[model samples]
Target: MVLLFRNLALLLAILLPQTVQAELVTKYDPVIYDPEVPEIVAIVGTIDARTPLNFSRALEEMPRATEVILASDGGSVLPALTIAREIDRLKLNTTILPDTGCYSACAFLFFAGNERASSGELGVHQISSDSGDLESGQLALSDMMDVLSDYNVPDDVIVDMLRTPPEEMHIYTPEQLATLGIIGTSSSRVAKPTTPTADMSKKDLAAAFVQDFNRLWSLPNAQAVDTLAEKYALTVNYYGKSLTNFAVIEDKRAFAERWPLREYLIEPGSTAINCDELTCRVETIVAWQTSAPERGARSRGRALQSLTLVWNGSGFRISVEDGTVLERQ
Candidate 1:
């Protein structure tokens, strides 16, 4: 009788749903939310072979989600691959949160999602051994190639990617990955309104300025900078000079001091530019003319332009940000 009771207890434990385990674990490792992004389900931690078990539960327990937010450094390849397979099977949308990334093996998971997106800052490279050295083992290379093949990654790309040392494995830019048909269109580049017309009062303008400035500063890409400049009717400093030479800087004061105008040019993220009579802004973007970095045509070009403005009830003020290179200026 005693033996039967013990056996019954063990069976019950084994039959308990994995969802219960997820609930228990989440109490210790909770997912944090970003108010700026309300729709994303943040997955914050190292993703390894062990992650699939918890992820399976997360998927089962969380409400039917349109997208999954993944952020992690590379971990065990086998487990990452498993997670990737599940993401594909589920046809879930995936995205990398800004200032976060899915590196190394974790990148494979990103590619497997039905629709891959990033807020910004998605880095990918190669895997190294536990000893922090390149795995010269034949099996490691073969296994890596197998994993790449599972994702339908081209052999040539795999060869070129692995040609570098593990420490120097090439990272893919969002554009590069998109061109390769890996991650789909990126969502971080969309233009946003700086402020609504209804909130253009003095206190509101100042508050919105600081808020937008901080957020833009966090992801200070040239594209974002350009959008902010256009919405505000501002000018960017290019090589210590004004941006009027390269691009059209709108004359908002001449148009009329107002909150919302009829026509406006903006960059990717929609930031409502306030080109009135009081404050102004501008943008400077340095980019290569060509795709190949070694080619002279690919040399970085400095472009300056006007972006934003504000109505001080007197005259327009232009407050443009500095044109500093985000990478290899």
Candidate 2:
């Protein structure tokens, strides 16, 4: 009896942790950590329904984490959406390191990140149905839109993303992503070119954009992009952005143009301020509306557009265009 009891106790001890681990697995399964960025967890492999257990397990462990590195060929959608929401809640940065690819449901996960980035080859395709019919395709599109809406993706943009034929996928670059607001502006945090030498004649907006662009690609994540954008007085708005080659070009141009008129929201009692064409200025305006007198009055406000200014040897050039401003006093 003594020997039997001793064996039972030993077994209990061994099984306790396993049981607890199994319970945790119900919500989360497995997660991988990298020694280089110990704060960053690497999530690779099929992220489908089968993988959700591991994904959940990893998420519960990673909220306190700084980053999540994701790379997958694609898999399930519902689970991926759930995983993405957790990433957003943790406010952790989601990135795809260089040469890593995030496809299908994995791409949706990328959208959920507070900061989303892709090193290279970030592919996002339309959702398909198990039956592979137009009705199924429509259903899948509707579902993806719902998921994107939860993440604050603009309805129009989500619609555009779904435009891909059931047969084709939507691939994107970090810059293309930033414009649409699908990928946050945090990607700009990478590196930026400093003011040109005294003799340099031209504005290196392209170079500057490129520097930030590469940085985002190097460490794709929503936080990183947001950090960079904030440093430069830049912000991204995805409300009306879309996914298309032409749309991509237009978005980049919007960044390059940085027009205050197009960028800011104008309201009564608001003033626009575009700093002088010098002094590496950031252009923006503030506006606020007093509530009308009747019953209870409320205040309305909006922010104007902002420009990232840099000293060109000739003068100041509006090198970068961020999001439109809102009403603010």
* Top lDDT hit: 2
RMSD of each candidate relative to the true structure: 19.7, 19.3
Q: How accurate is candidate 2 locally (lDDT)?
A: 0.50
Error of 1 at 168 (Å): 3.3
TM-score of each candidate? 0.43, 0.45
Q: Compared with the true structure, what per-residue lDDT tens digits does model 1 show for residues 1-329? A: 11112232222232234444321224212232322233344455666545777776655555465566666666677677777777778777777654455666766777666777764444445555544445544555567667666556633245435655656545555544443446653332222223335746543454344444434322323323333332333344433556652242333222222212121122343233333345544343323221332332222333333334454332233444444444432
lDDT of 2 by residue, 78-179 (tens): 667777777777777777655456777777777777776654556665676656678866776677777676666543244435666645666665555554
For each candidate, how many residue pairs have backbone atoms clashing (under 3 Å)?
45, 30
Question: What is each predicted model's overall lDDT from 0 to 1?
Answer: 0.47, 0.50
